[model samples]
Structure formats: C-alpha cells, structure tokens
Target: MAAGLVELAGVGLEVERPVRTRILHPIWLTIPEGARVSLVGPSGAGKTTLASIVGALQPASEGEYLFRGERVDLLDAKARAGFRADNVGFVFQNAHLIDERSALQNVALGIIDPTVEADEVTGRCLAALQQVGLAEVADRKAALLSGGERQRVAIARALVKGPRLVIADEPTGALDQTNGKAVLELLFSLDATLLLVTHDLAAAELADQVVTIVDGTLA
Candidate 1:
C-alpha cells in the first residue's frame, strides 16, 4: 500500500474546563496522497473535530498525527499555523466571507505569506476566482453575491494557495440541490487530497472512501 499523506494513530481530544469531557475517542485513520475521503456521522459526533485535527487547526490531546512523514501533533501553535498555511485549505458550511470585501480581496486573504508581492497575490487570487467561475464578479462585494456564488467564492479562497490537502466541513449543507451538486463536483475535481465531513450521502458517495463516526469513535 502507498504511504499515507495523513495518518492519525490513537488520536483523540478532550476538554477540561467545566468538566473533564472526552470529545473524541482514540481512533486511527490514514489518507493517501490525492485520495478523497468522506466522514459521515450524526450531528455532534466529532466529525468536525477530527477534520480540525487533520487540518492542523487543533492538536490531538492524545496519540500522534503525521503528515507527509512529519510529526504534526508535536508542533507549537505558531508552527502549526505555518504548517496549515503551507499545506491545508478549508471550506465550511458558512462561507465566512467579510461582507464588505470584494471577492478578489476575500480570496487574497488565503495567501498567508507576508513576503508575496502585491501583484503576485492579485494575479493568484484572480486565477483562483476564475477557476471557480467567478472571475466576472471578482470585484463585487461579498454581500451582493447569491448563496451559491458565495460558496463558490469560499471555494476559490480555499484554492488560492495551491494547498496539498483540503478539509471541507459540511461544505454544501446550506445549499439547494443544484448548488450543492455543483459544489461537490468542484471539490472532487481538485487535484489535492480531500477530507470531507458531510451529512449528505450523495455527496459522501463521491468520495473514494467513506468512514462513519458515531459518538466520538469510528464506527
């Protein structure tokens, strides 16, 4: 078997504030390069938490996380942020775009490296928007876009940096059927490895493999 691009060994999470609560039970998973994996589960089943851990947005409270043979679970916050900037793209159910920003500007925010020149950022952002079929509205404020358009813009933002992995959490949950299908097609067409969390079986079916999470453990 090919080596995994991402691997989680006995990974889990817990919260200790109000009361010590286990948010995720230890689980193991592997995702090879260029593979598409879907995570399906009931609400509050820890799907999003697992996606966050894989995306480097949060650390696993136990066990190890390896990405491309590197130990990601050991990184500090700043280092983890850098790792994510270099390798991961994320899309959520909500577009989370700034209402006053133009589509191009919104996409440009995805480029986290401060050393990139302005013209290059602009060029890259425009290209990303073009890829999502939103070049015509590149300069339009985000508030004016339709629901589907907004989600497309979100996708463009996620793709602007040419990430190796894309983690989408309920990406099409709020869309109409047609719009949801379009979004799923767009996501599946990307060249990167995909880790998707969704409740839609049709969307999940598009993945190369589907895994179920129930009440914090893989089922």
Candidate 2:
C-alpha cells in the first residue's frame, strides 16, 4: 500500500475522571496522500471526535496517530498547535469568520506562517478567494455576506494555506441543499487530502471512501 498521509493505529478517545466515558473506540485507519475520505454517522456517534483526533485538535487517549510517518500524538499541546498550523486546514459547520474582517482579510488570516512575506500572503489570499469564486466579494465584511458567500470565504480561508490535509466537520450543515452541494464540490476539488465528517449521505458519496461510525466504533 502507498504510505498513508494520515494513519491512526488503535487510536481512540476517552474522558477519564469521576465518571469515565469513551468517545471513540479503538480505530485503525489509513488515508493515503491526496485521498478523499468521508466519515458519516448520526449525532453523538463519535465521528467528530475521530476527526478531531486526526486534525490535531484533540489528543488521542490510546495508541498512535501518524502524519506522513511522523508521530503526531506524541507532540505536546504547543507543538501540536504548530504542527496543525503547518499541515492541516479546517472547515467547520459555521463560517467562524471574524465579522469585522473583510473576505480578503479573513482569508489572509489563514496564512499562519510567519516566515511568509506580507505581500505573498495577500497575493495567495486573493488567489484563493478567486478560486472559490468569491473574488467579487473580497472587499465585503464577513457579516455582510450571505450564507453561501460566507461559506465560500470560509473555504477560501481553509485552502489559502495550501495544507496537506483538510478536515471538514459538517461543512454544509447550515446551508441549503444547493449551497451545500456547491460547498462540497469546492471542498472535494482541492488538491489536499480530505477527511470530512458529515451526516448527509449524499455528501458522503462524493468521497472516495465513506466510513460509517456507530456509537463509538467504526461500522
């Protein structure tokens, strides 16, 4: 098999305390570089938990997580943050834009690499917005944009960094069918590896592989 861009070996999540609860059961999954994968499940089925682990937003409670053969689960919180900044792009159900910032500025905020020059950042942000067909709305504040336009700007922000992996959690949950489909189309068209968590079956079908989660385990 080709080397996995992301590998989760016996990985799981649990909250240990007065009353311990397992959010995810042991999962062994491998997504090769540039692969498109969707995780589908009902609410509270642990799909989001699994995606969070993969995205470096949450630490695994057991086993290991590797990105490009490097162990990410071993990194400290600060290191994990930097690691995610360098490699992962995220699109959530909400646009999560800074309402005060313009579409162009919002996308530019995604350029987290301090080493990149200011001019290059602006150039890349503009290109990304253009790629998502939001060039015309680049000057509009995020709060002034419509739902679909805001979501496109969110996508532009996610892709502006040119990340190796993109993790989208219910990216279309808040939009109408037409807008949702358009958003998914844009997400799948990206060059990066995609691991999407969604409740929509039709959206799941757009992926190269669909993995279903039931309760706390993959089914």
Candidate 3:
C-alpha cells in the first residue's frame, strides 16, 4: 500500500496482569488521509482496544505505531498526550455532553490549545456547529436538545479543533435508525480521516474500506 497518514506495523497488545492476556494480535494497517475506514467485529473481539491504540488513548504492548511516518509508540506519556490533542478527535457512543452547558460551551471545551484567543475559539466553535447543522441550537442547553441534536453537538465538538483524524466508536449505536443514519451522514462528510467502529454492516458500507477483526486479529 502507499504511504498513509497513519500506519501500524506488527502492532499488538497484551496485559501481564490478569493472567497474561493478549488482547490484540500483531496487525498491520494503514489509514490514508481524508479516507473513511470502518472497523467491525464481534463484541469482545478487541475492536475498541485497537481503536484506542490508534487514538493514543493507550499504547500497544509491542510493535510500531507511526503517524505521518513518524514513530508515535516511542513518545512519552506527556508527548503522547500532546500528540493526541493536536491530531485526534474522538466521539463515543454516548454524546457525553454536559447537560448543564450550552451546545457552544460543550464544543468550546473541545478546544485544547490554550493559546487560541477567546474570540477565535468562539468563531471556530460556531463554525463547527454550523458544519454539523447545529448552529441554531448553539445557545441551547444540551439537556434540552434531542438525542440527534446532542450527537450533532458531540460531532461539532470533535470538529471544532480541526483534527487530522476522527475516531468514532459506535457513534450511532445509541440512536434510532433515522438519527443513526443522520449521524453516519455527518461523519462521512468530514474532511479528516475517519476510523469508525461499528456493528452495523450498512453503516460500514459508507466507508471507503471496511475491516473486520475476529479473535484479536484482523480477518
């Protein structure tokens, strides 16, 4: 394959404690910039574990992780945190919004760069909300928004910082069919590379590539 924005070479994970469990078998994968890739697998098959590694939420037990051809697995914890803050945005099945906060406030919290001026942050956050079709509700409290609206706000939060990669773990798993499809559409419309972990085959079909994991290894 051609060089990609992110590359994993012989990456694997294991825990010495809890009786030496191997969660992910050595795997090689490449995610190109601006591409949408869906990861699907059975429950307990290590899909989230692998995605967590890719997102820098945790490190692999062994092997190489490269971002833009640079080794990331070797970065120290603080550096890894910085790397994640700059390059990655994540959305979980739960919107995880603060109900007491307005949509804009929640999205503003996603901006990790302290150097961003307050005005610029507001502009960026509003722009992101506009992108997700939630601009009208920018001032509405999250508690008052519908489920679909909350998810849209979550997406705006992810996009506010202009991340290079978006890792969405079952982003639509909590929505009904209509809302889920809308979320999927919004995700697919992003300019950034997307790694969507989903159980729905129909949702997976929206990606340029769909990968499956079975028994800790890519299938």
RMSD, every candidate, angstroms: 0.9, 1.1, 0.9
State model 3's lDDT: 0.94
TM-score-based ranking: 3, 1, 2
Q: For residues 23-126, what per-residue lDDT tens digits would candidate 2 score against the true structure? A: 89899999999989999988999998899899999999999999999999999999999998989999999999999989999999888878899889888999
All candidates' TM-scores? 0.98, 0.97, 0.98
* Candidate 2 residue-wise lDDT at 120: 95
How many Å off is the CA of 118 in candidate 3? 1.0
Clash-forming residue pairs, model 3: none
Q: Residue-pair clashes per candidate, as listed?
A: 0, 0, 0
Worst 10 residues of 3 by lDDT: 1-10
lDDT of 1 by residue, 77-115 (tens): 999999999999999999999999999999999999999
Residue 8 lDDT (model 2): 90
lDDT score at residue 136, model 2, on the 0-100 scale: 86
Candidate 2 CA-lDDT value: 0.92
Q: Model 3 over residues 65-146: C-alpha lDDT tens digits?
A: 9999989999989999999899999999999999999999999989988999999999999999999998999999999999
For each candidate, the alpha-carbon lDDT, in order, equals 0.95, 0.92, 0.94
Residue 180: error of model 3 in Å?
A: 0.4
